[model samples]
Target: MQAFSEILDQWKTQQPEDNRDDYYKIFTAVKDFDKHIARRYDGLRNSWFLGTVTALLAEKIITTSDLEDFSEEAKSKIARALKFREQYEL
Candidate 1:
């Protein structure tokens, strides 16, 4: 499995935005998500990895249709994250 940071770096390279403001939004969201996970789970974390996914979706950076093409492992991770979010209302 790729670390969340590695995945972000890969996306940054692949997407190549000339303007960085949107990318900063993603970075901030992920950072906030990590902090929340640390506080709520006492460092027993899972959903932090989904921060970028959530942010991207919310910002319309990616679509639900795009998610349909994700690898099985990616899909599983997203499912787990969404489950966690729903359960905790976070």
Candidate 2:
């Protein structure tokens, strides 16, 4: 699996100049994601990942058309993280 920074770097290269700020938002979110995961806060990690993805979709940082450009491995990680979060849910 690619590290978050590598994924971000790849993604940043593909984004248009006007949408670069959105990449920063994703960068911050990933940092938060790492922190949560490191602390064993499964729920927060999932929530942050989902929320960040949602916000990205809503804000058009990532669109259906461009989804393929994103890393599939990253998406898989998010999916696995969500499953882990569900296991710990009450």
Best by TM-score: 1
What lDDT does the true structure give each of the candidates? 0.66, 0.61
Per-model TM against the reference: 0.36, 0.27
Off by over 4 Å in 2: 1-17, 41-90
Minimal lDDT window, size 10, model 1: 40-49
Cα TM-score of candidate 1: 0.36
**Model 1 residue 77 lDDT?**
73
Tally clashes: model 2: 0
Kindly list the per-residue Cα lDDT of model 1 for residues 1-90, writing each as its tens digit. Answer: 134566577667777655476567667778977886566457434556466675456555677687886788887777676667768866
Off by over 4 Å in 1: 1-49, 55-63
Pairs of residues at least 3 apart in sequence or in different chains that clash in candidate 2? none
lDDT of 2 by residue, 1-90 (tens): 245667677667776667666667677778977885565444556547655664455545676455565578766664565455567751
